[model samples]
Target: MPDITTSAVAPTRLRIPRQRGQAPGTSPSGPILREHIDAMIDLHPGGLTWRRTFPGTLDHIPHARHFTRYLLADSDHRHDAELIAGELSANAVRHTASGRPHGTFIVEINRTTTTITIAVYDCGWGGVPRFGRLFGIDAEYGRGLTIVAALADQVGYEGAEEVGHRVWARMVQPSG
Candidate 1:
């Protein structure tokens, strides 16, 4: 693949066209916000990026995790990477249009000398992926993103509901 760099790219210059009267970066189905982000200062681009598309379903969550673990088998962050992959995949299926009939989600894993970035691209229509407050013990939901944020050094998302959403988490390690 060609080398992709974000050093010269500006988020303001990248805009997604939406319906008139609708929010600039929103969709009619849900409120997915676009984040203004810069590349992680500690991580460089031009690394090996592995991508896979999985049918959006709860049963496929393990597949996503397994794929991540397989890729990072020799790394110290393998467990964390797999867990992050599973959480993001679960969110895509449970909260986004990706769960609809025939919908699918894409998992992209990027590995640099000192960083591991995992991004999940969903079919959209779900609200912003944010860290939810730890609810009461009886609550069964709302912890996926929280756990992701805790394990990742950097986390954010981009894309509109009309198109799709890419929720990503980056785990950084000190370069030798």
Candidate 2:
């Protein structure tokens, strides 16, 4: 996977485009969904991107899910997106340094006419994510990525342990 930690724009602040009649700092969907977003870059002229930073904690997993749900509400894959966000965010908090006090993780969603991608960025303490060998239904852990892969057309990650990691899952939209 490409290392995004070295990107020049990694430190830039994310900006949500306003609707024609919308006020500054407000979401078109509803009242301003306040978050500590730090960076976001458009994938392309035709794609849409939104991202937010959350303090890494198990309690914040629902916030990440809600973010995905709000963004993909109009799409057919909203449920999958929400699940993916929750799983990835949980992993970041449970496996990475982002779980430490004062640590943070980022949730980003990129959408195009044919695809939707959800990603979780962590502070890079844990090793890369992987799908462990199949576990029986009674296994207590180790199935998040497997579930994500089952729902996504593609699943992978970027960056390194020292810098950070962005675990992402992308789903292709169904034909009309």
Best by TM-score: 2
Worst 10 residues of 1 by lDDT: 32-41
Stretches of candidate 2 above 4 Å error?
1-46
Instruction: Specify the highest-lDDT model's number.
Output: 2
Q: What is candidate 1's TM-score against the reference?
A: 0.72
lDDT of 2: 0.83
Clashing pairs in 2: none
lDDT of 1 by residue, 1-176 (tens): 99955454222332234777997656555422222122332244566789999999999999999899987765668899999999999999999999999989999999876688999999998877876566778878888898999999999999998898999999995432
Give one clash count per candidate, in the order shown. 0, 0
Q: After superposition, which runs of candidate 1 have C-alpha atoms over 4 Å from their true positions?
A: 1-45, 132-134, 174-176
Error of 1 at 57 (Å): 1.2
lDDT of 1: 0.81
